[model samples]
Each structure stands twice: as structure tokens, then as C-alpha cells.
Target: MLFKQRTEELNMKLNALAQSFIGFSFIAALTACSSSGFERTNLNQANQRYHAILLQQEPVTLNSSIPEGAVTGASFGLFTEIDGDSEDMISGMLAGALVGSVISAVTDGSNQATRYRFYNQKKGEFSVVSKQKFDKNVQCVEVHHTNKIKLYAVDSEFCRLTREDNSVKAIYGGKLQRIGTNAWHPATVIVKDELIIAVNPTSQEIPAGAQLIDGRGTWLIPGLVDGHVHLSQSGSAFTRPDMIGATHIHSYGDDQSWLIDQLPSLLEDYVSLGITTIADLGGPTKSLHVRNQLNCESHCPSIISAGELISATPVPALNGAQGPTFLNTETSAEAIAAVKMQRQFGAKISKFVFTSEAGLSPSQLDKLFSPAINEAKSLGQIIAVHAQDLDYAKAAIRAGADILVHGVMTAPVDDEFIELAKTLNVTYMPTLTAYEHYLDIFKRQLTFSEFERQFGDHYIIDSFAQLNENLSATDQMFQLFTRYVPFVDSSEKERSSLTPQEQSIVAQLETLFSERILQIQVANLFTVANAGVRLGFGTDAGNPATLHAYSVAEEINAWQHAGLDNLKILHALTEGNAIAYQIEKKQGSIAPGKSATFNLLTQDPLQNTNTLLAPALVIANGNIIDLQENK
Candidate 1:
């Protein structure tokens, strides 16, 4: 009977609580339909009151020593006293609802929750407010509930809220709660605009509505640098609509009237292949003309042209021979005139031929070439000479040649020559591929079948016939006259009476002669590279069957085959080349505040040398050139 009477009395008090305010029962019914139910209204009111305290006329300074009554007043919106004790319950509920709603609104909208403590003067103890968001649009603003509103103070962002039945709800909101040293409990985090953040599987929490990018399961490394390549060649290759095997032929000298006519296509081809820069050895003045054309086009690679060849003398028999003749010059004045003529033609480096076996005296050769080297220095141009024999090589170096185009073949490089080259900082470009090609021809071996496959049947027939004719002429004429038999008038007449079968045998023997030249060239190259000479890469482009630019990789592979360290080979391709060309400041290296040029590899090249051949991204001047689509 006593329990039933107490229940009736509590019911009457609850009815009185609901009847005290207008629309109070309607608000309670709406709350019951929501997820938070009755707690929604109370939480909303609590948020409003919290904002009111935060937006007070004066800033509320919080510290460790605050009274609990003042905190309760601030949290429960009890700024003014009520008329009666029964009115206190009604006012407290309204204030708590208002504060809770305002707090929830602020925390939800901004996505940041903070823990704070305030002193309540009426309760004589500290009170804590913890903010937490339960959904995208809603936040739960919780207040520590106790017998007298406060007894213990909230130490951090974490707080325990107690209900009338003694059930506890641990509230952690506002700032993310740090659970331990360097460890934080996950909670809603707020991110502001214009802030940079790094995300990993750690204590740092991402705020609600924050943008994120997944970087998991991936590694970042430095980009690649392709030291030698032909960008104009690449550009041209890509521009063509029906480019199939045409690019291959274009890479060598095509039948086009002007090689410069192919510059646009070449540039596109280079960009497509991720060749951001190139060092063109020699072409017609047409190389310079093509360079000017590429200057106006987009996606062109950086090009460094050596202009045309500056030979020992203009010999119509040799390939790509042009410019003023350096032969027949006996005095320094004539040699200086030759240098001036080359400079006027805009040669970056003066190239000359020095061969003792070519029938020039040491004194005459010195007077003919040394002045040109001196004149080049006066004009601040580098000297690159093609010297075949040891005497010529030594003379070229002694004449201050900056680059030795061919390796020393007549004899092993002496220590004196090596030391002198190092002292003068002279570079060597050992055209090993050309030597290899010569070897292939002499031995009757096919070095590159891919080249033959790409050029159709008609081209193959023509090329083979041309090769046979050249071999026949060399065997019947030059070889016999130069080596086997002296070109006596009577002997020549007698040799002419030989049959076609005998001539064919002589043609076959001609193969052996070419092979010997190639063997000598390779031996010379091996000697030079092993002697620690400064070496750079060059494809000797426009030569028959030699792959342009792409030959750089092959050269490195050959060097590795000869037992050089991979890092040393890479350095040769990158830093060493830069030093060789004196362009180290503008190119090379993956560093900040430099030109944003780099080659992207599909895999780490450090692990495998073959990775250098992989096709991937090419970034130049801060833009990614699309090679896949162009190809």
C-alpha cells in the first residue's frame, strides 16, 4: 500500500513538471519520436546555454581553482535566482535544455568539440561539460550530473555523466582525448581550411567532413634522370599519324631532302619517350635550323647541338663533310682562319681529325690544328677532335682539345696522356656502337635483326646490295692498294683480268678487313674507359643502322658488361655527363627549386638495371607528357 502511494505521488509531480510550461507536453512527445527521444530536447537546450556562456559579454577564463556552484550556474543557465524551491527544478530544466542545444549546435556545425570546466557558486564544487557528436548533423552535449551538481572537478576533455538512477555515460568530445603518451582515443576531429595535414595509422584523428587521400601500401622515391636522348626525334615520331616503323627510319637519316623537315616529328617522339633533354652530335646546319623550329613548338625537349663536324680537311668521300677545309694549312694564320670560319658558322665545339697514318707530319699537323684549338679557346668554344692513332691522340690533347671523339686505337693510352687529359679536364666520347657495327659487318654477323625487320623487303634488298658493292670496291681497290699489294700500274692491269668468282672471294675477304678495324676500335675503347678517362655518351646519329639517343642505355649496359659498378655507370649517365658538357647547374639531380624535369620509372632502378628500359611517366617543366597515348 505504501509503495503504491509513493508511485502516485511521483506521477503527480511528473505531471506538474510537464504542465508548468506551455507546449511542454508537445515538445516531450516530439522528442519521444526522435532517436534521442526526450534527451534531444534537453540536449538542444544544453547546447544553447553552452553557446550563451561562450558568447558572453566578457571572455570566461578557465583554470583549475573554480567553485562548483558557478559552473552549475553557467552550465544550467541559472544566472538569476528563482522565486521558490519548486521553481528551481523548472528553471534548471529549461536552462539545461537551452545550454545543451546551443553547445550541440556549435560543436556539430564546426565539427570541433572541447572539454571545459566551470565553477558553480551555488553547488560549492566544480562541474564539467563534455561535447561529443553522435551523427553527421547531431552532437551530444553532456553535463556531469551528481547529487549537488558537483563534487569533483573535470580534469581533462573526458568526463563521466551520471543520471538519477546512477547509470553512467562517459563523454569524450571537444578536443580528441589523449589516452596515453603519444596515444589518443579516436573521436570527431575538426579541420579548418588552408591547413596541411599528414594522415597515418596513428593518434591524429580526421575530423568529420574532412577530405582525405589514401596513401596506404605505397612508397615514394626520387624520380629518374635520362642524361642523353634526342627530344626532337621523339617529338617528330609522336606527331606522325601513321607512324609505325617510320619512326625507326626517321631516327636514322631518311631520304627526305631536308633532315630539318623531320624536326617537328622528332621533337614529339622524344617527348613521348620521356626524353626531356638531348645532346645532338652532328647533322647539317639543318640541326641548328630544326632547333630554331622546335623553340616555337610545345613539348620539345632541351637540346644541345655540337653543330657540324670540323674535320682535318674537307674530304668529299667522308660522311656529312662540310665547312671550310683545315687541310693544306701550313701556318698558324691559316689554321686560325679555319677556326674563325667554324665559329662564324656557330659550331659549339670544333671537331677535327688527327691521323698520323693519314700522311701528315707531326710538325705540319701541329701548325694546322694547334692554332684552331687556341682560336677556339679565345672564342670560348670547346675543341673536339677525331684522332685515330696514338701520335694524333697525344698531339690533340697537347693542343688543348677539350674532347677526344674517338678512342686511342694504334697503341694503349700511356699514363702521361691519361694524366694530361685529367689535368685539362678533357672528355672522351667512345663511339662503341660504331665499332660494334664495323665488327658485325667484318665478321658477316647480323648485329641488329630488328632494324632489318622494320625496314621492308625492298629496303633490305637495297641495303644488302649496297653493302655488297661497298665491300667489293674496298676489296678490289682500297684493300689491295693499301695493304696486300702496292698499286703498281702493271699489277692493277693484271688484277683486272681476274674472274668474277675471284672477285667474289676477294669480297668475302673484305669482311675480314672490316672486322679487324672493329676489333681495334673496341680494344682502344676498352683501354680508354679502364684508364679512368672522362667519358660521355653519344650515338653518332645519322650513321647507318645506329639507334639514336636510345643507344645511351646500351652503352651503359656494355660498360656494366665490362665490369663497372652500376652506380658508377648511372653517374656517368647523369652527373658525369653534366660535368662533361659543363651544364651541371641547369640539369641533373632531383632537388627542390630546380627545373621540374624527371623521368618516371615503373619500378625502382636501384634494384635492377633493366628497370631503366621500362616505360613510365615523364615530367618536364612541371607538366606530365603523355607518352602512352602518343605512342
Candidate 2:
């Protein structure tokens, strides 16, 4: 186990060194051909948020022409002397014309391009590869098109540059609605590079050559964030063998291979679904490898990951899962060592598994979690625990757990717990859909919404829809998993096309509300919300049936049913989660000097929660995402 920890730390170092080299080479290449220019453009673009100017432009050479070459050659061949060897002159002209034709044949092209150096007020200077030539001594508008920036010439007499700036994007005429606020107003948001320079400017404050985005009748808000997810799983029926024992149909090793290969696309899928950021609660060491890949990607969601789950007990349930699962630490010394290893591997949070099946005993909870919690605190890392059971959660909180990664279930929230949570400043994320999705996966019924069918990886979901294909495996899973939530009955079985043994798992399976623990989970959510507990939204994506991106709307429905208003839900999904995780400085809200990672919706998110799934525009780290392209 220590060897695995050492290997992960080594991997992080090698990854960083390699990435630095890659970054340097990329900047070098851009220097020769793209934005890294030879000299400063240094126009009136400094000390302002959204104004810039073009530094210089180099036009690509025009194509050589045979007719023009012939004319030039004829002129050279013609003699000024009168009546002297007209035939000689004709012969000379023919010979020169033939040579010119050969020369023109050697060099010809039509794809003319221009390399323009642009200086922004805040982001400094960069070069652009454009098809059209941008004029000098004038302001330009920068637009992202087809994964590249496009420049348009904008001229205005009313605008003047107080500081040197060449380019700016004034997204004009949109009703902006910020998270946690019901207020809306028509405003022009001026953006330079990736940050908002000005939300609304006076008429005289309009910068020269600012590109305008038609935000008319649109709702622009902060991009959504999924507070809890696991990149190690594939969000399919076979992703977890410890939970379902589906190894008979699909081995865990092969399933993980598919997921690792598909992880990059999954990152883009998150942004395409209007989620620009994600917090990976627990995964294997290779989750760091995925984060490395994410760092190199152009269009993807930002990730904050805990490299592996530091278990308080030896986990038999995770035996066949992806990567090494030998992270169980029992002693206080072992617990502190595990925290150090995760921190060395670049994990921002120290996450521990504290469930009943494979968690420390109630009496041993403080002894095991305390040392790790203390080490994490000393190392400036957050402590998150997977303690859904009420008593287990209380134990972790008392042990200085900063985040309860799941809702406190198995009991209702009382004044004692709420007061404790408030006093500890504990953040809670109620991953409402993962339980139901798991039930559906094991019970042999998955209701794929039209949105899920359209946006989700259909191949993965379709694998579960093969009726009678793996009924025995499904039954095996159902038998093993139903002990925790066994509300399925024969009445629902009579309506299905499946055999009696299968329990009709595919005919609009109803919510298992009769389950007492589930009732407690729902009741505890609204109780915490009204009690003013720090609440965040997460779907426990990568768990069985809780597909990434496609699962947000479903969880939104659950939040609504739990009596959380749409505004609160939106805030929880965005700024609330960021604030909980202490990452509001980098993301979570749309504000001046912050990263321009937000979404434009076709409908009001407050009025209709489902509309969050479909955004008209999504910007992640300043790169505009095309939703249809992902589809």
C-alpha cells in the first residue's frame, strides 16, 4: 500500500515536468505562428477590463499567377530599339514566358491568412491566426469561432481608449441574473479575454472596436458545478461490482478500461450540459492522471479530485474496482500517512470512507479519523467523509470533518445535529439521485428520459436495456443490494413483460418512498435548507445509472420535491458548492476579475428547472462550447 502511494506521488512529479515541457513547446510554436509576438503592441488597452488594440499584422503572400508572370516577362523581353529583329523579340518573349510559367507553377496558393498580434487590457498580448487581414491603428472585436478566435473591425467616434487596448467583446443587450439573487436587468457585459471587465458601462465608456454578443431576451447566469462525482466509474450498470456483483456479465477490469478510454469525452460532456466545474469526491490514483489530461484539454470542465478514498477499514466491497484499492488505514499513524500521500499526489481534500459496511467501528471512529483530520488541517486540506448514517455522520463531525459528502440518513435531523453542523461550519451535499438510480440499476428498470437518450452516452445506457440479456446477473445484484432499500413488490411485477422471477423492472418504476431511510433523506434536506445549513448539489455521478451531465435535471426535480426553491437549488449547484469547498476565489460566480465560465439559457432557470440541461451557450475557461457539436 505504501508502495502504491509512493508511485502515485512519483507520477504527479513526472506529470508536472512533462506538462511544463509541453506547455513551453506549445508557447514556442505559438510564438512562431500564433499569439506570442516579437514586440509589444502597447496601445490604449491597459488599466481597463475590456479594451484592446491590434499590435501588428502580417499578411500571407498572394498566389503566383501565370498570366501576370507572362505580362511581366513580355515587358522585359520587349526592346526599345525600333525595327530591329521583331522575330528575335518574339522568340525572346516566348522563352521568357515559358520560364515565368514554370516559376509560377512552382509556387501557388489561395488560402491567404494573416497573423495578427493583439493586446488586451487585462490579459496582455497574444497572436492570432486569421483568414482576413485586421487593419492597424483601429480597435477590433475578438470572437471565438470553430475553436479559434476571429477578429472583426469595429470603428466608432464616440469611443476612446484611456488605456492601451486593441480588442474587447461587449456582449450587449442581455438580462443578467446572478446566482442567489432574484434580480435581473438588461445590461451590456464587456469581456476581455476570459474575465468580465465591465457589467454595464456608460455610453461614453464603450471601448473602441468592442464585439457585441446579441444577448437579447436571453438569461445569462453562472455555469453549474457538480459538487460530488467519481471519474473512476462509468455511470453504467456494471461500473460497481462491489455493490452489484455484475462481474458475471461484464468483468470490472474490462469496464474500467472502457471508462478510462472514454474519460476525455466525458469531461467535455460535462461542459456541454452547462456544468463547467466538478468536484471528484473519491477515486483511484489515476484520477490524478485524468486531471492531468484535463489540464491539457481545450474544452472540458475543471476538476478538483481526492486521488483515492482513505478507508478506515479493509474494504472487501472494492476488491475488483479500478486501480489499486489497498488504501485502508486502521491505526492513527497509518491514517496520518494516508493523508500525507493524498496531499503529495495533489489532492486538495482528504476524503475518507466511513460507511457501515466497511467503515471503522463507532467507538474507533474518533481514534481513526482524528489523526487524519488533524494532519489534513495542519496541511491545509479539507476533510470530507462519506458518512450517510446519522450516528456515523455525527462522529465524523465531532472528529473535525469539514464536509459531510452525503446527506445524513437513517434518521431525521434534530436540533442537536443542526446546531453541531452550524457550529462546525460543516458543508452538506445531498446526492439525492444516486440512491434511486442504483435501485433502478439493480431492480432491472432504468427510465431514460428523452434528454438523457439524446445527450447521454446512449451506448452505455442501452447496455442495461437488453431485457433477458443478463437477467441472472441482474437478479444477483438485486439480491445483494436490496437489503438496504427493499420496497419492490409483486404488484409492480404483474404489469411488466419480464418473467415473474425478474420482477418487471422496466415499466416506469415508481419512487421507493415507503423506505424509511429514503424518507429521512428527503426530509433532512429541506430541514437543513430551512435550518440554514450549508447545502450543495451533487448527483453522485459515475455511480450506477447516474450518468454525468444528463443527471442534473433529475436531481433538480428531487430538490423541488424536497421543498427547495429553484433559486436556492441554482445557488447550491453553483456558488453554494464553490463556497462550501472554499473555491469561490477561482470559480462559482460571474463577477469582475473572475474566470468567464458561465452559461446562457434559452429559458429562465428559476421558472423551469429542466431548462438547465439545455443552454444556448456555455463558456468554460473562456472557450465557448457548441452544444450541438457535442450532440
Candidate 3:
């Protein structure tokens, strides 16, 4: 009898529970229909409340610190529009429940009420009100009497909102809240909509159709900067395929027609390799044309052109020969005249060649450098010199050259030269890779087999070989000079007369001479850079066996061989180069508001120096150029 009674009681309780659920469902449906009829008035009232809140709260200054509590209150005040224009009691009750639901969804504990001080406009004073924290996680607060709604949000946290139609919504901190899976929410909440319902704590499932991104495990870093390059010179006549070590290919005689014809394709190639910028040491006229072309295109690397070279009025003859057209002006006046000519052609910097071939007397040399310097100063441009020997370098410095284009090779640079360069603040573009390339070819008979494999074999054997052969007699003379140096002293005469075994020693001496020359060159470059002198990297491309954009990696490698830290190498490519070009303020760093120019490498270059050669994602002028498509 007792067991039967217990069973009957349980059945009765189940029936009552089912009946209660049915009644609640019917009431919810009726509420939805009633709310739909009043949607327009409710929305208008919400907008009015939002406008009132905005008028009450002044715009906050960005980047300024605000008290956390004050920020919370301000954010909540911004949500006043959620309460529709229903009966005051009904609106207040509904808005309170919504806020409560949100706080509950996001927070851990039960609901609690707290007192808040608000500015009462009508009374022109502060008033105390009781606000219950409906849900901690949702940040819901209930306004006791007023039919008003408000929501508060932190700057970076993610939040979910519910719409009037009982649909869920997701929103980022700034703008564009995501639409929830349920379409019941009004379409108005798609983007830029003010209606947001604080999600309930139990709602852990993502709203239908919400997109999520995993930002918790990743970080964003600034890109890499490539300081110097010549896009037009990469695959040109002087470049050979086998020269794997050549990084920069400086083109000497680039013209408008040639650049116009070649830059489009060349730029496409560079963009694919993540070269974001190039400092054109020569070929300004054509460079301008190329820059214009790139600007016309939707995306391309930046080109900083240095106009034409500002050599003496008559340029020096190569190897003291009269084979090609040379500019050799007699007086300093002629040099200044040449600078004026280049300036008129829109050159940004003056480039002059200080060489022994011009054979300018000391006084004339002084005059030549003076006028170029003065003109450059007047125009606010830098004067860079293609100085090869010590005499030319000293002369260029004495005349106030802003940059020394090549490392001194003919003679060792002394303390005095370094001091003068420091005093004058002259920058050095030590095309060390170029020197190394020449050294390898002359001493080791290294050929461009590797380079040819990438660039092509036909250019190497046909055009490149012909060019090298043209210089064969000059090379022979240099070889003969080395052979005769050993025979100068009688003490060395016996050594020269030695048989095959002694002859091997002579060959070793020749190798030593070549190595010593390169060491001397590196020493001078280091002296200048170490003595507080600025340095830039360039590949003297357009010469035989030089690589193009890829030469930058080799330059970094060479610097490491010379004992520079990886950071210093990076500085050379970034801040160092920016300073050399006088544009450090705008493009060198990843700081805010700076040009968004950077490289996306697979690894950190500072950690593993070889990472410099790794493929990267290149961004220039705020756009991601299609490297894969171009490749």
C-alpha cells in the first residue's frame, strides 16, 4: 500500500511539471508577437536614449589613462538604447532582466546589487541609485525604476550579445558584431547596430554562423627592411650566372627608355623576393621613370633614385684608356656645371667619380669637389663619390663628399682619413661584395656557373665572356706587374730562378697577395664604420658576375665574416640605410603611424643570420604584394 501511494504521488508531480512548461511556452509566444508590433517605437526610443547618452558623455581622449571604474560606467551609459518604448514598469523590468542575464552569463556568482552615483541632469547634481549585478560575466546591471538599458565593455575582451527576437549575436570590441546562428534577431544588428544583448553564462556554445579566430597563441611582429638595391641591374649585361656570391648589381648606364622597358618585369621579380625598397645610387633619370611606372601600378617596391652621377666635367677614362665616351672636365667650374646639369634633370643626389684617370691636378681636384659639395648643400642633397683609390677618396672627403661609394682598395686607409670622415659625417657604401667578386675572379678564376643556372647560361658564355675578354689585355698587364714585383730585388732573384718546387712557392705568394688585398679592403671598411661613420650596402651590379636583389644576403654574410653582430647588420639594412637616405623618420621602423613597410620572414634574422636568405612576405606602402602570383 505504501509503495503504490508513493508511485501515484510521483506521477501527479510529473503531470503538473509538464503543464507548467506548456503554459510558459504559450506566454513566451504571445510576448514575441506583442514585441514585434511595437518594434518601431522601441527602436526609435533606443536611438533617442543613445543620443542622450552621447550628449551627456564627452568624447574621451585616446591613449590617455582613465580609471577602470569610470571607464566601466561610461561604457555602460553608452548602452541606454536597449530599453524599448514600452510601459515604464514593463521596460524597466525587461531591461533589468536582460542586463542580469548578461552579467550572469559572463560572471561566476549569483546576482548582487550595488549602489552607483550618476549625474542627474534635471537636478544638476549627483544622485545615488541601486544597481543589482545581474550576471558577473555578462556585466549586467539593473536600473530599479527607469526604463533604460546600458552595456559596458572592456577595450580588448570579446563579448556576445542577444537581440530582441531571441537570436544570439557576437561583436568585436570596436565595430561589426557578428550575426548569431538564430535569424530571429533583427537583421539590423549585422554591423554598426547599437542593439546588443549581454549573453547568458550558460550559453557556452558559439552562436550559429559566428566566425572565430584563434589569437591567443600567436603574435604579430614588424617586417624586415632591405636598404639598398638596383632593380634594373639584376639580369643586365654585366651580370653573370655563375657568381653565387654577388649580391648587389649596380647598374651604371640605366636610361629612361631602358628602365621603362625593363622595370615592370624586374619589379615583379623583386616583389616576389620581398625587397621592399631600393636606393638607386646611379641612374636617377631612368629611376624616376621607373618610380612613376611603379606608382601607376597597384603595387611595387619603393625606389629612391639618386639622379645621374656627378663626375668631373670630363669623366675619367677607364683603366686610363680612351675606349668609351668619358667625361673629363678641366676645371672645378666644369664640375659644378655638371652638377647643375644633373640637378636640372631632377637628380636627388649628386654622384661624382673621383678617379686617377681624370688626371686632374691637385688644385683642380679641390675645385671639382668644392663646387659639387657647395651645390649639393644648396640643394639640400647629398654628394656621393665613386672613389676607387686613396687619393680620390681623400680628395672627395676634402671637398665634403657626403658619402664614399666604394671601399678604398688601392691603398690602406690610415687613422687620419678615418678621423676626417668622422668629422665630416660621411657615409660609406662599402660594396665589399663587389670587391670580393673581383678578387675571386682574379685570384681563383671563379666563374658564374651557379648564377648562370638561375639567370641563364647563354648570357654568361656569350655576352659576359665577350665583355671579360675585352678587358683581357688590362688583366694581363696586372698579372705581369705581379710577376715583375718578385724580380725587383736581387735577394728575390734567386727565388724567381728556383725550379718547379720553388715555382710553387711563387704561386703561393701570388695567392697571398690576393688575400692580403681583400683583407686590406675589409680593414678600411671596418675602420670607417667603427669610427662612428655611417655605412650603407650596395652591390656594384651592372659589372660582370654580380647578383641582383639576392646580393643583400651575401653582404650580410660578408659583414658577419668581418665580425659584425646580427643586430648591427640589421641596423645597416634598416635604420643605417634610412639615415643614409635622410628619411629615417618615416620608413625604418614598425612604430605606429610609420609607413607599413616590412618583410615577413620564416624565422628571426637576429637569431640565425642565415635567415636573411629565407623567403619572406613583403609588405610595402600598406599593401601585401602578391609574391606567389608574381613568382
Going through the candidates in the order shown, the clash numbers are: 57, 14, 36
Compared with the true structure, all predictions reach lDDT values of 0.47, 0.71, 0.50
Against the true structure, candidate 2 has what lDDT? 0.71
RMSD from true fold, candidate 3: 16.8
- Candidate 1 residue-wise lDDT, 51-144, digit = tens: 1011001123233222333354354443222323547756775666566666555444543343433322122122244333223222122333
In what order do the candidates fall by lDDT, top score first?
2, 3, 1
Per-residue lDDT of model 3, residues 1-631, tens digit only:
9998987676567556655665887998898877745554455343322101010112222231223334443333323322323354355445555565555445533323343322112221122322333232232122223245443322222211211222222221211112211111111111112222232221132344332211111111223344445443433334322222221232223322343555665555545555566666664343455365454343565666665555554422221111112234556676677667656656566667777656675456777568667877798777777876777788888887877876786678887788878787777777777666655544435455453346433433354354444443333434443343353222555665767755665565454345566677777767666776777666664444455555566667778787767666766666666777777776665443455555545555566765554444455554545665665
Q: Point out the higher-scoring one by TM-score: 2 or 3.
A: 2
lDDT of 2 by residue, 1-631 (tens): 9998987676567556656665887898877787665345454333322434454567765455877777765644442211235577687677767776666655544547787755554554566766675555555554443334555666522123333333466555567774357877767677778777677732223454555444656788788999888888888767776666667777778878888778888888888788988888877764586567554243778777786788766656555444554377767898888888878878887887777665457557777778788989999887888887777888888998878876987788888889999999998888888886765655555587777887788657875764237656654545544432343444443435445544433222333323455668989999999999988888889888888777888889888998999999988998888887888886777677777778888888888877787888887666667677765
Better of 1 and 3 by lDDT: 3
Instruction: Indicate the TM-score of model 3.
Output: 0.55
For model 1, the stretches where C-alpha displacement exceeds 4 angstroms are 1-258, 285-287, 295-298, 318-331, 449-532, 613-615
